[model samples]
Target: MADLSTLARPYARAAFDYANENGAVDEWENFLFIAGAIVNDKAFRTWLENPAVTAEHKSAALVDLYDSQVAGDNDSAFKQLLGENKGSRYGNSISYPKVSPALNNFIKQLAEQERLALLPEVYEHYRHHKAVSLKQLDAYVTSAYPLTDDQRQMIQTRLAASLNASVVIHESVDPSLLAGATIKVGDKIIDDSMRGKLQQLKTQLTA
Candidate 1:
């Protein structure tokens, strides 16, 4: 099979373009994140894999799930003001009509194409596109130990400067790294760890 990212490209590009054009990129990101998570659920995945389940039914289920989650916040807010029963009833009735239409259509489009399994990939690709368009990067750093505040700041600054984009660092400690760290952003990696150096030296010696 083709790579999942390859399959996700067109849809991700389309959604990103639409969202970017409408100044709704962030909003769409939030929507995609939620939708992706829902589709990624074990229960949902099982149902999704059932050949007997119609696409329209899957689409409706996704739409309903998305709608209920949004409305749930409203339900809570209403409950705080008007008490439980009345609030929940009112909130449940109050569909995110304006928001729902766009999402409903998007989900329906995916279903029509039998491509709903692509949501998680779509979201990931969409997020990557978003980051590029916004001049932001998500960087992962694995080190031998926790990064101090100064170390974190220095890494963030250097990465931002080197990449020419705003950088957000996610740190993990892997003692096996022995020393130093590896930074990953998108498809790029900067490996400066003792483990990496040893491996490179071993490869050269073997060669």
Candidate 2:
């Protein structure tokens, strides 16, 4: 497997710069979303990898697709720039070069090595890196009922005390949880939910 973080570093830095320079964080966000969609599409992936298709053709197709979906002031110019450079030699390359030349060159190097297929993983790592850089923690908490502000604040305080860092919580109501709350901080889950408690009881009974 590719070292996904290494693959994503340049791209992430490029995106950060692009978003910073243009004050277009929203644009970069949309751009990455579009790039991810294109990378994940089977037909697009095949076209990018197909040796029979000329680079020019693939590039043109990408330009059309991106121009239509990635709505922004400089989007058309971005597409034109991509078309001029020729489509990436790598099959997994994401055309998010609107913000940074260094990012474009980095991905181009990956393309030459035919490592473009790792773009999805790279993107994942990129998000994590960006989150860390911004001092933000991405977390999801699932609960059977909506947590009151007091309850949420208590949990946040506990998490901060335990993890030694403040967290911005993303909470969701999942009636399927039955009752109680399940807190997830990064990859760690504190499953205080009724479902989890029952499962533990069941396991212990069987044991």
Query: Which candidate number maximizes TM-score?
Result: 1
Worst 10 residues of 1 by lDDT: 78-87
**Model 2 stretches with alpha carbons more than 4 Å out:** 1-30, 54-68, 71-97, 147-154, 198-207
Residue-level lDDT for 27 in candidate 1: 60
- Residue by residue across 6-85, what tens digits does model 2's lDDT show? 77667666666656676655445444545655667898798779888665555445445555643334445445543433
Best by lDDT: 1
Query: Candidate 2, TM-score vs. the true structure?
Result: 0.61
Candidate 1 clashing pairs? none
The lDDT, on a scale of 0 to 1, for candidate 1 is: 0.78
